[model samples]
Target: MPVTHTYNEEHYCKSKRERRNHRMKVGFIGTGSMGGLLIDAFLSSGGLLAGDVIASNRSPQKLARLAQLHPGITLAESNGETASRSDILFLCVKPMEFKTLTDEIAHCLRSEQIVVSITSPVQIYHLESVLPSKIAKIIPSITHSVYSGTSLCVLGSRLEADDRTQLLKLMSHIGTPVEIYEHHTRISSDFSSCGPAFLSYFIERWIEAAVEATGIDHTLAGKLAGEMLLGTGKLLTEGEFTPQQLQDRVAVPGGITAEALNHLRCSLDGVFERLIATTHKKYDEDVAKLDSLFGRDGITRRK
Candidate 1:
C-alpha cells in the first residue's frame, strides 16, 4: 500500500552530504484554526523549517493564506498527496471527518510514516483500523503558539522508540508534552486546551465589570487586565508558588484584594463544577457517536 512520491530534482539538499543535512518533511492535512496554529508554532519556534513542510486544506483560500504567510512552504493538491510525501503526517481535521479523511489517505500511508491526529474523540485504536503508519494523538493548545503550556500525547502500539523520541522532541520546542492514559484525554484537554478560552472569558467579563463600575476606557481596562494575566502566568510558571499560595500572597488579610477574593469564591463556588460536568456530558455524547461509527469490539481502553 506504499505510494511512490517524486520530489523536485533541482531542489537543494540533493547531494549525499546535503541529504544528510536535510530535516524530516512534515505534512499537515486540514489547515484549519488548530492546524494552522500548530504549523505557525512549529515554524516560528524553529522546530521545523518552512521548506521542509507541506500542507493542504479543504479550502483553497486557507491554503493560499498559509502560503502567503510562509513563502517557501509547499502546498499539496490533495490529502493523499500530503500523506504519501511526508515522514510525519498530521491529520488535523474535525472529529466527524476522521473516518472519511483516513479512508481517503489510508492507501498512501506507509508503515515508516507517523500519522498524528489532533482531534480528541478519534482515538488511536480507531485510527489503527485504517492507517498502517504509526499513530499518535496529540491534544494541542492555543498557548502553544507562544511556545508555552502543555500538550497531551498518547502513543499507539505501532510507534517505535525513535518515533516517540522524535515526536516528543518536536513537541518540547513548542510546549511540554505530557503523556496520559486514554480515559484521561477529555479531562486533560479540558484543562489544557479549553482552559485558555475559559480563562479568557473570565478576564473579558472582569474587564467589562471594571469599565462599567468606574467608567474607565474599555481599551485601557483590557490592557491592564491582559498585562495582569501575563504577569500572573509568569509567576505561576517561573516562581516557586502554587496557585493557592500566590492568591494568598496577593490577597492580604483585611485588604481590598481579600474582600474581592471572598466575593469571587462565593460567586464561583458551583461554576467550575458545572463547567466540568457540562464539558464531560458533551464529550460523552461525542464519544458515543464515534463509538457507533467504529464499533467497540477491539478498542483497548488504557486505565
Candidate 2:
C-alpha cells in the first residue's frame, strides 16, 4: 500500500512555502572511488542542483559512466574546462598527479574560485604555489558518503571568511567539519582518513581468530564482529567515558575480560603502540617526500 501524509490545509501550505532552494556550481577533477562518494553525498544533501555539478577525469570511459549515472552532472572535456566552469573546484586527483594537473588548470582558475584539495601529503602551500589561487585542504573519511563521517578542514591563508563559511556549510552536510590548522592536517589524516582501514584490519583479524577458536561459521563471526564494533562506537559517542574508562568498566577485577586483555597485551607486545608509531613515521616520510618534490620545508616544522 502507498503511504500518504494527512496534513491540515494551513500546515501543508506553510510546509510547501518553507522548502529551501540551493544551487551551486561544483566541479570535481577526479571521479574515482572517493570522488564518486563525495559526489553522491553532495547530491543527497539537497543543497546542490544536479545541473550545477560537473566532473572531469583522465579516462573518457570513467567520465562517460559518471555522466550516465548522474544525468544532472556535466562532463567537462578537460581539467581546464572543469576549473573554468566551477565556482568550487575539487582537486580530487592522486598526490602524484597534483603538480601536472594543477599546472594545466592554473591559468583557468579565477580569483573568486574556491579550490579544495583532497589529496594527502600535498599541503595547501604546495597547492598554492602551483595554482596561485584561493585554496583549502580537507581530509575526509569514507563515512562521509553516509553523512556520519568526520572531516578536518584547513583554510588557506588567502581564503576569505565568507568562502570558508560556505565551504564549511557544504561539507557539514556530509560529516562533522572541524576547522583545524594546516599543520595538523597530517594528524587528522591519520585518524580521519586512514583510520577506517586500520579499524577494518583489526576487525578482520578478530573475526578470523573468533572463527578459529569457536569453529563458528566465518560469515557469522564477521557479522558479530561488525555489529559489536558498531555498538562499541555508539557507546563511545553517546556515553561520556574515555577509552581507558570504558576498558576499565569492561575489565572487572579478576574477570575473564581482564584475563583476556592481559594475555593479549603480553602476546602482542605493544602491538597497538607499534602500529601507531609506524603509521605516523610512514606519514611523516611521505610528507617529507612531497615537500621535497614541491620545494617546501614541510607542512609542519618539527622542533
Candidate 3:
C-alpha cells in the first residue's frame, strides 16, 4: 500500500505545483546513502519532481545508479557545478570532507541559495564560515526511507524565515522535522539517526535467542520480531500509551512477560548509560579533530 500524505503536506505540494512546473532545481553534492534516500523520499512523496533534482557524486557509479533510478534528474560532472546550479543544495558528503567540499563550491554559491549539511559534526558555524548562502544542518535517519521517523534540524542564524519554512516544509514530507540546538546534535542524532541500527541489533539478538532457545525457525522468529517492532513503534508514536504504561498493560504481575521484563531489566542495567557515554566520548574526539582541522578554538568559541 502507498503512504498517504497529511493534509498539510498535500496543501504544501499543491502550493508548490507552480514552482515544480517551472522546474525549481534542488541539487545534491553527494549521492550517498542518506542523500539517495532523501532524493527518493522527496520524489516519491511528490514534494519534488525527478526533473527538479540535479545531483553529483564523487563516484560515477553512484550517479549512474541514481540516473537509472530517476531518469529525469540531471547528474552534474562536479560538485561545484551542482552547487552553482541549485537553488537549494544538500551537502551529503562525510564530515571530514566538509572543508574540502565547501571550499570546492564556495566560489560558485550564491547569496540566496540554501546550503544544508546532512552530517552532525560539521556544524552550521563551520559552514557559515565559508558558504555565502544560507546554511543549516539536518540530521536524517535510515527509517526515513519508509517516510517515518524524526529528522533533527538545526537552523543557522543566517537562514531567513522563508528559507527555514521552505526547508521544514520539504522535510515534513519525508519525516517529522524537529528543530533543535547545535549542542543537542549528537544526543539527538543518537536517538534519531544512529537509533535504527542500535535498536535493530537488539531485535536481531532477540530473534536469535528465540530461535536458539525454543527451536523456532529463524525465519519465523525474525518475521514475528519485525512485525512486533513495527506495531510497537506505532503504539508509541500514537501517544495513547507511555512505554511503561504499555508494559504494564501487557505484562501482568508474575506473568511470563513480566518475568522477561525483569530479566531484561537486570541484564540491560547501565548498558545504555555506557552506550551514550561511549558515543558522546567518540563525538567529543571527532569534534576535537574537526576543531583542529578547521582551526576553531572549539564548539564554545564557534557558538
lDDT (CA) for every model shown?
A: 0.87, 0.78, 0.84
Candidate 2 lDDT tens digits, 168-232:
99998898898887767766777788888988998888878888898999998888887887778
Using lDDT as the measure, what is the rank order of every candidate, best first? 1, 3, 2
Better of 2 and 3 by lDDT: 3
Using Cα atoms with residue i matched to residue i, what is each candidate's TM-score against the true structure? 0.90, 0.86, 0.90
Clashing pairs in 1: none
> 1-303 in candidate 1: lDDT tens per residue?
444334332452156676457688999999999999989999999999999899999889999999999989999988877887788888999988888888788877777789999978887888887678899999999999999999999999999999999999989999999998878898999989999999889989988888889999999988988898888988988987899999899988999999988998998899988998998898888877877677778776455
Q: Which model, 2 or 3, shows the larger TM-score?
A: 3
User: TM-score for model 1?
Assistant: 0.90
Alpha-carbon runs more than 4 Å astray in model 2: 1-22, 296-303
The Cα error of candidate 1 at residue 280, in Å, is 1.0
Residue pairs of candidate 3 with colliding backbone atoms: none
TM-score of 3: 0.90
The C-alpha stretches of model 1 lying farther than 4 A from their native spots are: 1-22
Off by over 4 Å in 3: 1-23, 297-303
